[model samples]
Target chain A: MDLSDVRRHHLSVVLEHLVCSGPRSRAAIAQETGLTKATVSTLITDLLDRGLVQELDTPTAGRVGRPATDVGAAGHSVGALGLEIDVDEVAACVVDLTGTVRTVHRHTAGNRDVTARTVIHRLRDATQRAMADAAHMGIDCIGATLALPGLVDPNEPTLFVAPNLHWFDADLRSLATQLRLPEHFPITMDNEANLGALAELRHGAGQQFDSFVFVSAAGGLGAGIVLDGRLLRGAHGFAGELGHVVVDPSGKPCACGARGCLETLLHSDVNPDELARHLADALRTVVHLIDPEAVVLGGSLAAFGDEFALAVADHLHADTLGARWHPCAVRRSTLGADAALVGAATAALDRIISDPTIVPTRALAH
Target chain B: MDLSDVRRHHLSVVLEHLVCSGPRSRAAIAQETGLTKATVSTLITDLLDRGLVQELDTPTAGRVGRPATDVGAAGHSVGALGLEIDVDEVAACVVDLTGTVRTVHRHTAGNRDVTARTVIHRLRDATQRAMADAAHMGIDCIGATLALPGLVDPNEPTLFVAPNLHWFDADLRSLATQLRLPEHFPITMDNEANLGALAELRHGAGQQFDSFVFVSAAGGLGAGIVLDGRLLRGAHGFAGELGHVVVDPSGKPCACGARGCLETLLHSDVNPDELARHLADALRTVVHLIDPEAVVLGGSLAAFGDEFALAVADHLHADTLGARWHPCAVRRSTLGADAALVGAATAALDRIISDPTIVPTRALAH
Candidate 1:
């Protein structure tokens, strides 16, 4: 403790209560959080002025004197900008405090045909347009996150490599600067799969499974592992590289120069049964290693329907070591193609949701 | 939180400071933890009364005025018991607060030839003797943990399944009663691989790499995964079943009714070159999924010397997708065969280290 730490802690407690328990009276928040009523009222006032929370019209009408007004997280006052640069398309979206996507912009482009710089500029332009829309709607953009289809530098705004994107060691900071984001607005970059996993955790399959492995296969095969309600971005942020795992040692060479990797089996002419077998084989390894509760298939694979998921699940069940006792479910992604963009936006908003004190109050707002 | 929560939090901070930073003066601890000198003095007094910490004779000789006494974690005053039930033997040991093994007893026997009840009794006898040893040394055993070579019920003292031990749904609570441990002396059960990973984390390879996978092949092939300095026990505590992961899908049938598991390639007559290839294949999948920083070979497999490890490492490096950027090392276990036992004891002691307030004061001690 410092004074600011205590203030932020109290503010977060009140904000999280409304976010998790729906609207609640200030007195109820005090009782639930074990804070004094006076303290709760002061914290609620701070949150209300910051545009992070709003007073609801509903009152404690049942057998109560001078009805207490309910408070809740503000819906449209603030939002986060999420940008994605995929292999074939550029997308941008703004997500509000309640995890609702308010605006979306998608542009199909020959991303691989153009230089990495050109794709970056295109994504930047999309982000600029999204910001304009957010400002026009009076949605205070608290932060922004760019979802890239590659290995992101855990320490810097850089992309280590995106084999499918034909890019290596790309600078993301320059792009952030080009967007001319508000100073100290906290723009960052993350891997697409990781962000997609975050999106699923906040808005989709997360309701059913707290721990899962999100597998996406639109432009490339990748995985995002969530365990105990948090994303598992391993020792160098390269934890879920499911595509490169060698499924067949004597099989065809992959784009990453590996022989018989999981990606090699996803050829257009490949049979579903063969792909299912290979996918099950690789997923079995993942289940054995991390032991997630469910396997959520996203990207183009979710469109394969229930039968495909069943086949993969069948193989997984047959060979899983403790399948009889430890059951693992396999299902399709609820968000489908929108998972990555939504996840990117969710990641941006989480910066504020996790620390409400970071938001400037109305008096300080420019 | 309540008053007790605040008290425990402060106590934990003071105890952890001594454990992690060595001996420190009261003023130094208060400065480090940001607690007032009066509060630190009260917490330290409480810890002293509970036999968790001791004041050292060393004084601030170079400082002005009266010399300030140093306080540090008490090594011999308190300890935890660790019991192990392996395929061929029963082992028990006591580990003091400093993580040093004080007493160890290993009884080698043909455990497979006996009934589950008979083996349980045998382990009970070993635990009884270890408790006597601990008592003779005037060490208060705060807790006890049993390590088994199978799935441990995370919520109970039950052993879900120990395939090699020929045990299923073993009633560990009954065994706990038979040992007649002190009242409120917490006793728990955990998987051998999980404990081994914990041991490696606190005392062995954990010093070098915060995250690594401990692969052991003595009784059977098992892996204990540690990521970001914590064990990655998947949903249902069934993670790290490396032995059962299918390696040669078209090869021989495994004992688990699965065809071509990693364990099948580890037969006595199997060629090292072929075995290394299969192990590497399975490990490549593990690497892609969890991305641990190192792979630690333990038990019988570690005795294969540097050549076998190097062969496996070479194959793993050659095929791992992000090998060029994210490097993973392969090494032998530092604690060797004793990892599980030490880890079990450490896990037992962690119960107190994490919450020192739980330990009754000396005046309330039995």
Candidate 2:
């Protein structure tokens, strides 16, 4: 392999280590990565030159050697613009490389009843506000990520089905054209629940554990599955469609054409107790399928808090079930409505830091 | 890093390519891996010396250079031992490195009625017979992997529970002592469904897709979650316990003590029609959550064939179910009862071939 490619790989490994572990000395990175001290030093210097790392001036004593200076990630300068098109509103935010949602711009609108043109324009308005805010704050935009509540095809930039939004086969690339986005910026579209899980794992109720199920209940039910620190998006990128699960064989027919689908039950004009019962039954399905550490309830269920948890635990114990004892905790979503926006920003920043070549083309700061 | 460690990593890369993508020339491998031609040559020579690869007389017609000789994997020389402990039987088999089951030996017993000691004896007897068969057939024994229909923590060598087998926290390491296995021949204990999914992904219905859910139903429903190719066991190793999901709030209480659970519905003394309806309802939960390409039915349901497919399809379509046309095909288990055993063999062989240092310590062939 060429020296440059090798160097890039080493730099990636060192940068990933620093990002995941907070900060470390060059000698510590070398020891952890099994790389030589000289190689790690060269990589650290390169990262500094690229505006990806900064000297922390924190001295750390080595077990067998002299102390070394520590370096940390430089996350303040570069930022990611994350936008979301929800049924209730269009939201936008700028998140720095440090995984902080620095600014938020939200506009309330009944997006489902509006035309696709109206929705796109509203999203454009939010993006403009977010972009201007980032510009004023001197945070350079790395890239943009749009989150939607739908089954997005991983192979294409298309939202295949957002039943709640009543938008089918929505082409995001053309929509970006409608928004008049810059040519250098690339857009990535994904399911909203997936982004919520990323945000929760990074900075929400799921921060304590490496794996959990992020259940977003708004106009419909969706689950973002994270296991072993990775999101489990199926082959078709339609993995976590938890709302469509059958709650009753004889219940109401859902838009999915299934009798007794969980979403139809959740949306029924029922009392709070009845609503919690329906939601819990749906959650029981998730717990049985994937016994995660916690089920982080977001969207509509976030406000219920203890009412929701007690109801779900009343029927099926979140922690333990059966003779085998499969235990899981139930908690409210930490980020709530902002999870998707924050997660999109995290993803964009992640892409830029991991693959620096894209940074120059996408990030205005670089 | 030392030259040898670097070579091992490159060797792993080259061998992984060969194993996954079939045979390729040194020049082709160098090009594909971004390794130098000289480095590829050195790694190839090392693998050949280790009996992991062999050169063939088949020559490739190059577009510009002289024809190069072809090489392929040496699989027959090394074999893995797979064993299984289920409610109905204790089984064992030997599989070659190329993913072929050379021998199968199984003993039928009412495992659920028997004590843990009795089941362990039956498993030992089965392993002995299978090991003898492998020896007689000139197949080398690569360490054994034991599959149990229960929850197994990765950090512990124990079976947490096998409800059908009436087992709770069965100690595998102590049981290995009773089986009299050699010290270096490490025994790995995992959930039967996880192993079944691995077998299916490699040789069964799941070979076509990188992601799908393998549902193992016998005494209970268990899910083997394969996402982006890796099996997802949650942080606590208690994932994929699908039978525990509540189906009918008014239904009978399960061993997990939840009323109207999926397992309770499945186990009701019902006709094939009723059984299929229950199974379909349960399958619907999996499809809604994971959205796999296909749901490969295994365990007791494998024998039902179209009866199971028709019944499940009666209420819920296997694929294309709703306003969201999620078309996932339905297929029966290819290996049936042989899945867990075969998958265990695959795991054992995979471990040995991928990490050569473990080969000599465990596998008799090395």
Candidate 3:
């Protein structure tokens, strides 16, 4: 739907929420949203007319006299494309509103110029393949969203910095245009950590949390901070640059030229697999600063599993803060490689239903 | 107005915004808030009926058709009270909605027990005097809010820890009750730094920026963080304890029993006036980590003026981040000792105007 079709988009959002959260009566939806019951009933009726929602016969107890019908989103009204851009590989998937992956595609990075043009070319081919696979399964794809590891400007379709990809100043908007996608089809992009956090917030460990920081540890360390039920993109869209924050002054010199950045010490290259003991010792200082609910360890390194996460958590516990032993649980990302892709799909769905204007059509050309 | 009177509160809020922002046409308010023009018109009419807002008679050109009526809040409806509790003193003030302080009261402290009880006693006496003065000037007092330098449970009316006061687990709600406050009146308490940041967000340097950290340096250090237009209270209301975050592993011992906490290193005792040069060197590390919009210097130390703040800022600039130098501006708090007090008053006023249920009445006193 386009920006002009806000009413339809609003209905789609209610339908999507109902689908994600299971069936609920119009009264329940109105209660949760503070929307008028009449307005909700009208919206649900519109959704039913569009074949986006189905009313079930079941009635919830608590209503005195009248039986309320529960309505849920249709599972196959539309589909979303999720793209994940890594340093050496790209992964794409088609996911339904309920977060079920319908199709998947993976590609490797060649010795291409890691510029906007080159990445867009790879994305276009991958998207085509995924769409074809989905089509074979009778699934209709709607739009796409890309998730990458680096700084991203939400206002502009572009990468601020993707150090591992050796890309900088890449215009994602123009790249998507070159791919020749549908005119009004929307595309969205955000940092991998942010996407990971979004995924967790919607479908995993962070779902119940109002504030938490998701740390992605791979080629570089990045954080996705969710505060008060919203992602915190700082004043300059650089809020979650937790990796660049100085952790130790006398330690290793980072590429960012700062001494002992969280990434410089925590990354696999700096500590190595054999130096896990030393890594635990180094991490003690960081945990004391930001006392997050849970320090979620994601990315390729998290594949090592619970042992590594526990060792780091153990060392952090030994460090005393004001005679009170400060402890934060450390856990690995469950989605692993697909986390960012899932996050991207969620972002795309959110855009389609909440703010159609946010997604740049040019970014989805491929 | 009670919580049941939501429409009245909402209209009052619009009128309050108009009053704070000066005269604005209904069309302008509707555009600024994304509220429907019809809704704005209806609300404006209701506000005019209540005598909370008045329509301007002067007509201005520039509109396509008929000029809209300008509306603004009646400036003399209510006054707010702010109370600040420090280690050695208790300060109180009565301020108008426009942030004009009509009167202030200051009291000294001798010991923890005596101080806590005496502060509340003095606060009520001072508030009564201030109300008398306002009554003579024809302004009505609404409610009071207290700002304390410690961990506070907003859900519970108590001070968790007032280190300088040497009070722990003090029942502040009981004190408020003993003072015999008006029924259903709002009396709120919050962390000093959070309120300081709130004050800045609503009326100071932070108004233009959505996210930044406000560090209050006094006998100890505390931070007020604003992220995405909301305060980040963390999972537990103790999010902005930047002072207690361990910075040095083997540095001088802090009162909190940690070595080299930001507070221990930056506080007045650790950095005596004679050792300003040495303290400036230690302060550089903090400035690098959180490259905020501006490092606001508040508390008693701010009275020393630009020289002290500049010395700390000078050291921060010397420490480069990569090839780029950190350039967060340093400014002293304009509110002085009254900052936390003003912040508390604002918080109280916010609670009174938003949710009457949250405001503990003597009837519901523990």
Candidate 4:
């Protein structure tokens, strides 16, 4: 690699260490990253100049030599904007670089049976309101990510299809153009299920489990799978699609045009016992194929509480092949229904942390 | 990284390039790896001395400068031993470093309901005969991998359970001790389905597809999933347990203690049409979850031919959610029944390719 590329890489490595591992001394960063103390100090200085990191007042107390200064991700100076378009709502959230949510603007609108242009306008308004709130709180929006409830085109900002929203091949470029988002703003799109899984990985069950599936059952049945700490998007960015898995071949037709999908079997009319059974059948497919460490019930599913979680766990325990040995835990999502929004925000912040060079060198205006 | 670690890493990189990408001149290797020509030459010289790579007589002809000599993986100088223990047979195969099978010994025995010790004894005899054949062919075994029809403890040479073989927690370390395998011979254990998938990835349908599932239906139903060229082993080694996925949650009890499993529904008594539907249910689960490029059906199931494959594909097309946009192909296995054996041997060969330093420096005996 060239000198500039190498410098950018080192800068990202140092910044990521502080973001992921929390506050630590330069000596510890050098020891962990295997870079020389001089290189780390230089990178930290660059990050500080960019207002991405700040040195803390607390110093090493038990050191034999000079006490090293602890550095951490700067709060409120830099932030990310997360936008979401679900079947029944359009929401926006702004989170600081430290992953603290500063503002959330959720508008409960019947987004279904509507055109993509209408939904995008509503989302744009919500985003503007959320950005205003973030600016009021001293947070600077650096990048943005939009999470939609459907198959998202991984290469571009396009929502290929959302059965629940009755939206197909929606052109999301207008959202960026209408908002006048910067040319290099790092605006991206992702499936809400994938974003939810990412949020769980970053701030919830992911802290304890490296591999798990986050099932979102808000207005639709979907799943976000994490394997070894990475989201599994599959060959066509359509993975973790639990809603489409066929539960019965001769059963009812699904919204995706498939017959007898797991989504078809799951309905509000079904009693708790039957609901747990249907969920177990879908979770059974995940447990069989991925054998993840746990399955986090997120979105509206967590609202069912412990009784429902235990019922689903019982079914999983009884049906899974290696339940006698490797038991897949069924847990409730700590982030509840906001996982996808949080995940979207986290993904946006990751852009800056991944390449701190994007952040201009400037001090925080006091 | 330390100096030794860096050197070892570069050596492995050069060797892996030759093994995976075929023979290339020193200049090409240097250009591809971004290492200096001098460093590539130095690493190549070490590899040549170790008999892991051989210098080819054909040189680069169209280059502007001097014609650089081509280097390739050695053919018979080093080899690996692959052993397998199934419910009905014990087999062993030997393959040279270039992934060429040199010898194979198969013994058909009803290993079901038999003790793990008895099966291990038979496997040992088959391995010894194969090793003798390999020795006759001027191949020296550097490592070995044993593939079992059960869950393998990823951290050790232990078979946690093989329901078909009725073996639970079988101690495979004893087999290594009985063979008097070297302390660092790199002996390991893996699930046969996983081995089959790896083999397919290296030599079969994996050539055309980056992500696919290898379904093994010889005596029991199992699946080996490859996503983006990497095997998905889940949180535990028990991933790809497709047989136990409940098809009829209350249908019939399976050997795995799960009622209404897909395996329970799949029997000789079931007709081809019914069989295709059952198979499609499982494949649908896979496609919905992974959305792979294709699904390669292997083991005894491949014997059913194109008619069965087409029927299964029909069901998948009718049942899959996004079949129009992202259609998943259904294909028969090209390697047939030998995929697991080849995968086992290839994995053993991977040990040397992954760390060329493991092969001691020595010229070819000839």
Candidate 5:
């Protein structure tokens, strides 16, 4: 690549850093990014001209040097849309460059009609409303991300299988195409747990740790894992299926036709009210094995409050080897129902900045 | 950074490509590395003068230009040693830049006290013998890697636990210090399962896939997972504790004081013959969950033969979501007892090349 290409990419990178790592001075950015002061200055100038970044009035003073002007992402300059399709509901949200969800919408779907076309229609209507609201707010929607609960074949956009939704061999891309989205816009999709993990990594409790696991206890239990600072998507994009892992050989029968899966014991179907008790019993078995830094609880079950997180933590502490003094902290989701939406927005924003050619699009009307 | 620093690092990258991805002519290397032909030629000449690479006699004909000679790593220039300490045995091997194991030594420890000091002493003696034998056959060892079963804190050289061998918090670097090893020689220590996964990634069934899980079903059950082309060492280096994942809520009690871990189901406690059936049953559960690209049967359980693998495969097929089709392939480990040892060698080789300042130490004296 030419020097100009490198410089342009660096500019985008600086913008991303500003958005992800919060505000910082030019010198601080240079130290964090390992880019020279001259290069950062040049990139910062370019970003400022584009209205992507702005200098704050507050100056940062340190022991060794003069006060430096702090800079941060210009939240209004760029926006993204996040769409989440659960078994019973569809959620949409518009997020700004700094991962702030500015608007949210939720629509309950009819029971048991989760076919590919039905989901496509629901998504189309939801996106249209979300985009309209975003426009009303005077913000441009730059990209959209879709999150689903199932295995997504990364190589093939259309191939997905969500057991709870009874969706199999569905062509998501074809459905999106049928919606007639905007020409320049692109729709990105990923597994819900993966996106949840990404959200935690970028914006939640997982930010401090290089590796962590995020468990979503909803209709079914799933885990999003981060290792070496990256999402651990397996060979077929089927990793983090912690629910399917057998916690009992002859326990309850799971929807996946397996007996004694972790999901069978911890899923909402077992007993929504008693989920904390069930999760505590189940987690007592896993804590000693991995000894993770922390285990985060999200999804609808996390809404049960600190009681659920505490119950699991207590059991883990009691069951771990040597009564390991350090119990993996269990925290509830901070974003509530809007987490997946926020994650989807983050994913969309990441996709756009990583590859500027990607354009934002709206699902086509039937 | 200066332009020359970037250029030099870029050249080193080209040299690494030539070493790892086999040989290429100067012109081809230039195109692939995006460096100019003159730059490539100069680097290749410097490398050749240092005996790091050799030019092939055969010239290849191309449609667009004259034939050119291919240059490749000088296999005999540098070598690495890998040592694996198991509960019942110890294995050592020497490997070249091309990942070819040239010499191997296996010794029966027969349930001896395997403290860090004792293990280091044994390794030093074995290394001496192996080096002498290799000298007679014409081979050299430039670096060493040690693979041990435990929760290895990467930031520290002590092991948290090696349940099978009954070692806890064993100081590895102290043992190295006591041994008085050679200066400027690299030595590395890592978890056995992680090393086994690394070995498979570089030289075994996983070479073709970017992500896969290597389950070590031996005296204990553990896993080494690779995601997005990197090993998944969780926060605090305890990521792949697959054996500890609860597989049974009310089942047998695990040695880790947990109830029904995969290790409890899979490992052979007293005699291999006594636990053969249990091993097969546990392997079935493992195959049903992750559905990895390939299930490699290694450790002591692999010695049981294809019947064990086929039996597990049959159970997996019968219990999987879609019993109509097999989800993943099953295979026996080709490296057998030496898998972890070879992996250690690979890790040592990587460390030596990445940081030339590493010093190799002699084995600890009893």
Candidate 6:
């Protein structure tokens, strides 16, 4: 790593430590990061100067040396606006550095039938309200994220396709332009499933796992592929597409013109035991491919709850050729419907913390 | 990243630049890595001292300032032993720092119904022969990777399940112990599909793509999921079990007991067009999920050649929503059936060059 990269990585590490572990002295950070005390002090001081960390006036007791002054993440003034454009709802919220949800506004309506212009305007209203709400809370919103239910170009904030929303090639970034956020306050546009997986990993069932599949079954079956604590957004950023996987080559046709897709099999009329068995069967392919630590079913699928868990268990265990298919744990999403909003917020906050330059207003003004 | 981690990262980067981009002077490296000339010099000196790099005699002109000494990866003396235990054959080879495949020995035979002990013995023979061949070439074998046909526990280098070999939870480290190469000469055991994908990505069809699916179809269909240039080995090192993906919920039963799995469908009796259609169906799922740049068909499936490509292309292009399903270029694996062997070799070579400590026999002795 270069000198600048070293500084950046250290800054991120120190900030993460503070946010996750609460206040800690420089010595504690050094021990945790395996950096020298001098280096840790330098990084922490740099962060403090950047307003990313705060010195706790109250001294901490536990230490190898003198009672050391504690420092914690101080990016309290900066929050992120997270917006999700789903088939069933248009959700917006503000998330702080500690990942606490501050203000949440949800517009529950069928997103499928809405015109692109109307939805964008509605989203604009929600975003403005979210920003206004954050301002009311005295938190300066820096970065924002618009999580959509479709394939997105990570490099471009353009919605390539939203089968559920019936929006294709819609320039989602136009909303950012309308919002008039500064260029440096980067806005990320991505699949809601990806962010939902990230949120679950950070604050929900996946906290214990570095690798797991987060399946968000709503209007469609979307998967958030997390390997090694990192969400897998393939080369084109269209990953975790569980809904389109052909489960039955001869079954019903799909929106993508495919037959026997997993999406077609998942419906309200489907039997719970049969749905669980089918879901488990589909999941087995994922399990066989990426033997994950666990499969956390999120979104509307979370409604399946314990019954779904039991059915998945039965099918997964059925694969046991004595020990070849030792079933991994199956669980429901703890965040339920809020996974996407929380994840979008977390992703934006992470970007701001990792590179404060992106949080333009605060960095330049400070 | 701490001081040591920083040093390690720079060392790997420098060595990679040398091996991949050919030799470069310290000034060029500094420019490329955005490191100070002094830092590059220190890192280069450390590598030279460790005998992982050597100062090149010919200094080139395009460099700024003085024609600084050009250094390149000097681990040609150390090599990696790569072994592939497949359902159809046992393959082993020695790969050097420049990724040159030196000695290859393939024991072609049906791998089904073999005892783990017997297969291990055969692999040991091939591994010993490959190492002996490398020794004859005056190169020292430093690290080894054994690629198998099932789920692997990365932490233990043990086989979790090899449905094709009927090996379940078999302690594969026994091969390492039985071969008894060296204490510090690290050994990696992983699924063949993962290795095959890595091989294809490194040396064959996938170099152009940061993400792609490598389908190794022999007796069964296995996918190696690569996303954003990193291979996805789910939590248990068992990501990419495409063969077990339920293709038909009520089709033929598989070894894993699931009906209509991709594995059960890949039999010789299935027409080539039908097989391609089935494979295309599976590839569509991956495409919708990750939107990879290309899908490279490897292993026995490559034998189908243009016929397979035509079928996949036909099906993929059939989804002509014009935007939702943009058919990514699909082609046969350039490495064909040799992909797994090459991948195993490349993976091992990568390990040795990245960390010379694993080259205990050469690094320590020298």
Candidate 5, which segments miss by more than 4 Å at Cα?
A2-9, A59-66, A136-138, A266-291, A320-327, A353-366, B2-21, B24-43, B59-65, B130-142, B266-291, B321-326, B352-366
DockQ of 4: 0.61
TM-score of chain A of each: 0.90, 0.86, 0.78, 0.91, 0.85, 0.89
Local distance difference test, each candidate: 0.83, 0.76, 0.64, 0.84, 0.68, 0.76
The Cα RMSD in angstroms, rounded to one decimal, for candidate 2 relative to the true structure is 4.1
Off by over 4 Å in 2: A2-10, A17-39, A56-70, A271-274, A310-315, A318-326, A360-366, B2-6, B20-40, B56-70, B136-138, B306-315, B318-326, B360-366
Give one clash count per candidate, in the order shown.
0, 6, 0, 0, 9, 6
Clashing pairs in 3: none
For residues B267-366, could you state the per-residue lDDT of candidate 4 as single tens digits?
6478878888888877888888888999998997888999999999998888576677878998888888888988899888888878888878876566
Q: Rank the candidates by lDDT, best first.
A: 4, 1, 6, 2, 5, 3
Tell me the spans in candidate 1 whose CA falls farther than 4 Å from its real position: A2-7, A17-43, A58-70, A363-366, B1-4, B20-42, B57-70, B363-366
lDDT-better candidate, 3 vs 5: 5
Give each prediction's DockQ, rounded to 2 decimals: 0.63, 0.49, 0.25, 0.61, 0.39, 0.57
lDDT of 3 by residue, A1-366 (tens): 122354555665676568557778899998886667887898776666544566777846775878888886554655678887777777778886567777788888751346657776777787878877777766556677788877676777867667667776677776456656667667778888888888877776676665566767655667776665567665544446656655555668876555665566665355444334444433332333333566676775577777877776666555434113225666777777677888888777665456333322233223
lDDT of 5 by residue, A168-239 (tens): 777776644655557757677877887888788788877877666778755567777676556766566666
Chain B TM per candidate, please? 0.89, 0.85, 0.79, 0.90, 0.79, 0.87
Per-residue lDDT of A214 in model 6: 93
Q: Which TM-score does chain B of candidate 3 obtain? A: 0.79
> What docking grade applies to model 1?
medium
- iRMSD (1 decimal) for each model: 1.6, 2.9, 4.4, 1.7, 3.8, 3.1
Q: Classify candidate 3 by CAPRI docking class.
A: acceptable
Candidate 2 lDDT, A153-206, residue by residue in tens: 756788888888998877776766777777757678788998888888777887
Q: What is the TM-score of chain A in candidate 4?
A: 0.91
* Reference-based TM-score, model 2: 0.89
Instruction: Estimate, for each residue in B1-366, the C-alpha lDDT of model 6 and write its tens digit.
Output: 356777777778777777666777888888997778898888777776666678878746685766667787774576778898888788899877766688899997777888888877777778888888988888877678888888786677678778778777787655677775666567888778889998887778888887788989866678887877678776657677777666667787877776777778876478888887777766666676666778888877778778778788788767523324445878789887778887887787787456654443224334
Model 1: clashing residue pairs? Answer: none
Off by over 4 Å in 3: A1-13, A24-41, A54-70, A110-113, A136-140, A268-292, A307-329, A355-366, B1-13, B25-31, B34-41, B54-70, B111-115, B268-295, B300-330, B352-366
* Chain A TM-score from candidate 6: 0.89
